[model samples]
Target: MRLRNCLYHFAPYGFHATWHHLATTHHIPGRIESNPSSLVRALDELETARALMLPRAVAFAAQRRLQKREGRRVPAALHPWDSWGCHDIAYCPDPQKHPAEPLPVVVDRVLGACAAGTDRAGRCLVCGREDWDLWRVCQNCGVASGGRGAHH
Candidate 1:
């Protein structure tokens, strides 16, 4: 089968995730087709192509992040074929950028004033407890608060 055909068959996960799954699984070539050796060789060739693209991918992500930081709008690729390129560029690590704040620290700072009753408007939606900690559930009635679907 053509590589493009195989790609179409596995397109639901996107190319990266599909390749990652195949690499991690290490299944035999015969499992995919009649020609066991050729299938393995084809997989290896695809992997090599992917490896060659990594540096460019990383650089592109870093550039996108820098563009976002500078308050400039990102330019769209000229070609429709390239339009669906990486959008999760913030997940990439850049040496020039400061490390992200730890989740616990952020949560603490956000909830600290609320917990201490400094923000009087902040109250538990479930128990209506003004004194409850905002970082966790309502301390009065044990109802979950502050994350996901919880009302502030």
Candidate 2:
């Protein structure tokens, strides 16, 4: 399960590595690499792989969450983070910047902040729109409210 999850998440990287290996090992022609047919075939393979892997990944994630909720211990190998504490999945761009807190907790905090209309709320600089979502994306201009644009 852990292996499947990791493979699903890192499929793109694996594809690239495989492509490089085939190009080098089999002496794949540069002309073939540049060909539209080759590109289409590679992309088609990637899409097919994604279709196959996504369902399994979703199932594993759901099972893990369910196990956690049921007070059952998920196997250490099945954990999102590895033994060395490195993330097995690449969901977050910067895990350190955004710790893996519960979704409900994060949602509640965001909702509360938006409800309170705290310092995070402000006008959108792009179009001077006041309405913004919890993510601070302006409803009026669809731009992010940040820096001097954000107001209390």
Best by the TM-score measure? 2
Q: Write the per-residue lDDT of candidate 2 for residues 14-107, one digit (tens) a residue.
A: 3233344223433445676455455444444434544544444566677778999999988754222222121211122221222123222322
- After TM-score superposition, the amount by which residue 20's alpha carbon in candidate 1 deviates from its true location, in angstroms, is 21
Best by lDDT: 1
lDDT (Cα atoms) of all candidates against the true structure: 0.39, 0.37
Clashing pairs in 1: none
Report the CA-based lDDT of candidate 2 relative to the real structure.
Answer: 0.37
> Candidate 2: TM-score?
0.35
Structural RMSD, model 2: 16.3
Runs of candidate 1 with Cα error greater than 4 angstroms are: 1-33, 79-152
lDDT of 1 at 85: 31
Q: For model 1, what is the error of residue 49's alpha carbon versus the real structure, in angstroms, after optimal superposition?
A: 1.0
